[model samples]
Target: MILTVHHVTTYEYDAPMRGAVQSLRLFPSRFDGQRTIRWDVAVEGGLRGGNFRDGAGDKVEGWSLRGPVSEVTISAIGQVETTDTAGVLRGHREIVSPFAYLRETSATWIDHALRDLAETAVTGVKEPLDRAHRLSRAVSDAIAYRPGTTHAHTTAAEALAQGEGVCQDHAQALIACARAVGMPARYVSGYLFAREDGAPHEAAHAWAEIWVENIGWIGFDPANECCPDARYIRIGSGLDAHEAAPIKGIAQGDGSERLDVTVALEAVQQ
Candidate 1:
């Protein structure tokens, strides 16, 4: 399947700022499951800076804008060809050890409830792959998908206790549960094509990936209750949502900032 994406993010400050700096992980990943066709990223009135692939194999680019400017916009447009690998991340190159993901982040911190859930889900399940699938299923069963029920800063424990959240919370909760079972897991940010069932879903999405002993990293979308397939376009990953965010930046000024984002994904005609 071929997917085309258009994503735009805008920042508006009440007062003109002196400058702004941004780090972007907006490019698609390189792997057997997905190949980049054509991609471009641009920032209006911004200067592009150092760009490189991080240890985790995601492309990172820097940008800066000098101002007195009150508004800035970043846009990314791309096409990618993807194949279903049953959520297995094959042929992606990265030097970071999977164990590095075992380190907990504030967003994915495990509590007694998470530990118990992990243990109960994996109990009597021996195969690492099976354990991972069980964990994903457990999280899916635990959290009801509901938008606006939680905030960006909500932690895994809080989400689990609340029993309702969006994709980000589901991904983080799954990450915390996976780590509780001694598995290395990380959060993934990307785009998901509209479901065949026509269910409502955000074009921009988040998921979790767990390291199976022999399987490397495999993606699991508890929000969708399935493994990633051709409909999924890989972008970037990190220990939590903040790290995996496609855009991270700081604007110079005391002026308050308002952000608006829009993303659209569609299947390309063959």
Candidate 2:
């Protein structure tokens, strides 16, 4: 399938601030499943700086805005052809060892409750792939997809306890659960074309990736209860959502900041 994407993010501040700098990880991942046809990024009134592919094989770019600015906009326009890899990340060039993801972040810390949940989810599962599927299903059943119930700082344990969260929470919970079962897992950020109700879900999306001994890394969306296929576009990953954030920045001055994001994605029949 060929997919076209247009995304824009705008930051508005109540009080005019000084300088600002941002690290953007908005580029799509290079893998056997996907190929970028055309991609462009623009920063309003900002200077572009050095950019390079990180060890994880995701392109990271830097941008800076000068003083006395109240708003900054970042936009991306691109098209990509994707194949269904059944969630298996194949032929992706990355030097980072998968074992490194074993370590848990604060957002995905596996506490006693999480450990029990993970253990119970795969009670009879013995194989790695089957275990992963069971864990994903268990998490999906455990949490209700309810936005605004959890914030950016909400942890996996917190989300599980509340039994309500968004995609980020589900991803973090899956990571925590997978790690609890002695599997290596990390957070994935990208785009999903459809929601459970078949609505447009293609925007800033998050999921989990688990590393199997012989199968490599596989993407799983516990929130959506499915594996990534042709409809998914992976961008980058991290130990958790905070690390894999699409945009990370430091503003020189700020009283309060509000952000708005818009995305457009559609299929191009080929």
Candidate 3:
């Protein structure tokens, strides 16, 4: 299957920003089940400073605002060819180390709640792959998918207690849980091909990947209750959302600023 994606983000400041620097992780990843055929990122009211790969192996571009700009626009367009591996990304070259994934981050703390959740999710389950699937399903059943209730900073425990959250929360919760169980888990940010629609959506999707002894790293999307298929496009991988965030930056002068983001996709079947 082939998937095309278009993602646009705009930042409007209440007051003009001077000497602003921004980092972007909007580029799709090239991996075993996924191939980036063509892709380009464009910026308006901003100039590209440099491009580099981040710790998470995400292709990132650094940009500087042009002339104390009041607004900045970033757009990315791309096409990728993907194959279904039944959640098994076999024979793929490993870009990340499993041991490295165990390191804790601020957002993915292994707290009591996480430990308890992990115990419940994996209990009475045998087989590493099957345990992962069961945990994913348990998360889906435990948390209701709802919007406008949680933010990017919401913690795994908070979302679990609330009983509802978006994909980010789901992924984070799963990560926390998996980590608590001594599984090397990391956060994944990417595009999920919507069944009713297609690639791009209101926002990029989030998923969790756990490392198994033989299989290495395998993706599990608790929100979707399945492993990633051809419809899933890999982007970045990190300890948590903060590290894998699509856009993050700081301005020299900061009073208050408003951010507006829009992401859309048009599917081109092949």
Candidate 4:
């Protein structure tokens, strides 16, 4: 299946920013079961300073906001061809070491709640693959999918405690829980195809992947509670969403900044 993606992020500052630098991770890389045919990124009200790959191997672009800048816009467009591999991404070169994924982050720290959640989610789950599937479903069901209830800084325990959050929250909870159970889990930021109209949505999607003994790494969308298929386009992977964030930056002249993000993931018929 062929997928087309459009992601636009605009920052409106209450106060004009001068001499600001920003980092962007909006580009997707080619991997097994997924191939990027064409991809480009454009900026408005800013100049592209440079581009490089991050520690996690994500393509990143740097931009410098000109003085007296009140708003900055970033747009990324790409097309990718994806194939279903029975939920297995075979022969894809590992971007991060398995040991690194097991490392805990602030948001995904192992705790009692996480361990218990993992135990319950993987209950009666014998095979590692089966456990992953169950864990995904359990997280989706356990946490009510509600927007505006959580933010990017919300941790996995907090979301689990609240019983409500968006895709990011669900992914974090799942990752923390999986790690608590001694499974190496990582975060995945990407796009998901909507079910109602088969149209793309404005917000980006997130999921979790766990490294198993024999199967290598497997992805699970706790928000969607399903394995990645043709509908998913993976942009990057890391210990948590913060590491794989599509865009992150700091401004020199700081006061407050308003962010407007719009993402569209469409499935094109051949």
Give the number of the best model, judged by TM-score. Answer: 1
lDDT by residue (1-270, candidate 3, tens digit) is 888888887777877777678888888775678888899887786788889876556788998875576777788888888888776656544456688888887777777867787898888876887777777777788788888899978888889889999899889888888777778888898888773234333447889988877777899988777788887888887889998888888876664777777666555774
**Over the stretch 154-210, how does candidate 4's per-residue lDDT look in tens digits?**
999889889999888888888888777678888888887763244434347888888
How good is model 4 by TM-score?
Answer: 0.91
Instruction: Give the candidate order by descending TM-score.
Output: 1, 2, 3, 4
The residue ranges of model 4 lying beyond 4 angstroms of the native Cα positions read 123-126, 196-203
Worst 10 contiguous positions by lDDT, candidate 1: 194-203
Clashing pairs in 2: none
Candidate 4 minimal-lDDT segment of 10 residues = 194-203
RMSD (Å) of each candidate, 1 decimal: 0.9, 1.2, 2.4, 2.2
Per-model CA lDDT versus the true structure? 0.95, 0.91, 0.79, 0.79
Residue 48, model 3: Cα distance from true site in angstroms: 1.6
Error of 3 at 15 (Å): 1.0
Residues 1-270, model 1: lDDT tens digits: 999999999999999999999999999999999999999999999999999999999999999999888999999998999999999999999999999999999889899999999999999999999999999999999999999999999999999999999999999999999999899999999999975367978999999999999879999999999999999999999999999999999988899999999999989854
Query: How many steric clashes does model 2 contain?
Result: 0
